[model samples]
Target: MRNNLHSRKINFVQDFLRIQNEAVIRRFEDMLRQEQLKLAEADLSYPMSLEELNTVIDQAEKDDRNGRLTNADDLKKEIDNWE
Candidate 1:
């Protein structure tokens, strides 16, 4: 048997996808479809609306300045609590 790099790569990806549970693959496909739709409708030349994004950035900066942030321990604890 001879090995081809492109074929090997394709087989690896196919195996990876096959190993994923059906429900996970379906959900991933749905997310990919949604992202494709978003890209299709996106306007590259459109100016960004700063009002909402600026507010979010300002809030994040304020939190950082005030030391209102989580440490690794806090993040681990939060993840542990997740359902």
Candidate 2:
């Protein structure tokens, strides 16, 4: 019974793929790439101690309150000016 149910699920997926248009296939490919990127990033991450995490979060909040964040475009322009 389990094997029959699994085979039906696989057949449904195969049938769906067979009918998808080029645009739909491209969208699926893009989604798959995004998922792969997320998986790769997950593999590189390590857990931090609670104290260290809290310290980092506190520093971020402090920076936000102090208006210490730089705009991405402004930072890019500044770097270009350096060169």
Candidate 3:
């Protein structure tokens, strides 16, 4: 399976390098960008691992102990004064 994938990637790079049309290259660039954006959005929706969740919770606990949080009433009042 690894060898098959390696050969496919090699062939794709060869084919991609032979392209002479500017518009076709731009289309491939656009498609690659769209796929990357979709992958990023998908990454955001997955649950974090236990260690990651714990790290976030730890940070929040430290922040709370240090009085880094604001209450809802203060937040609403601050937002109301925003330009």
TM per model?
0.33, 0.40, 0.60
Clash pairs, candidate 1, are none
- Best candidate, TM-score: 3
**lDDT per residue (tens digit) for residues 4-62 in model 3:** 99999999999999999999999999999999999999999997999999999999999
Candidate 3 backbone collisions, by pair:
none
TM-score of 1: 0.33
- Over 1-83, each residue of candidate 2 has an lDDT whose tens digit, in order, gives 99999999899789867975988888777988999999988966967789988999999999999999888999999999995
* Candidate 3 Cα misplacement greater than 4 A, ranges: 55-83
Model 2 misplacement above 4 A: 1-47
Instruction: Tell me which residue pairs clash in candidate 2.
Output: none
| lDDT ranking, best first | 3, 2, 1
| lDDT leader | 3
lDDT of 2: 0.89
Predictions in order: lDDT = 0.83, 0.89, 0.98
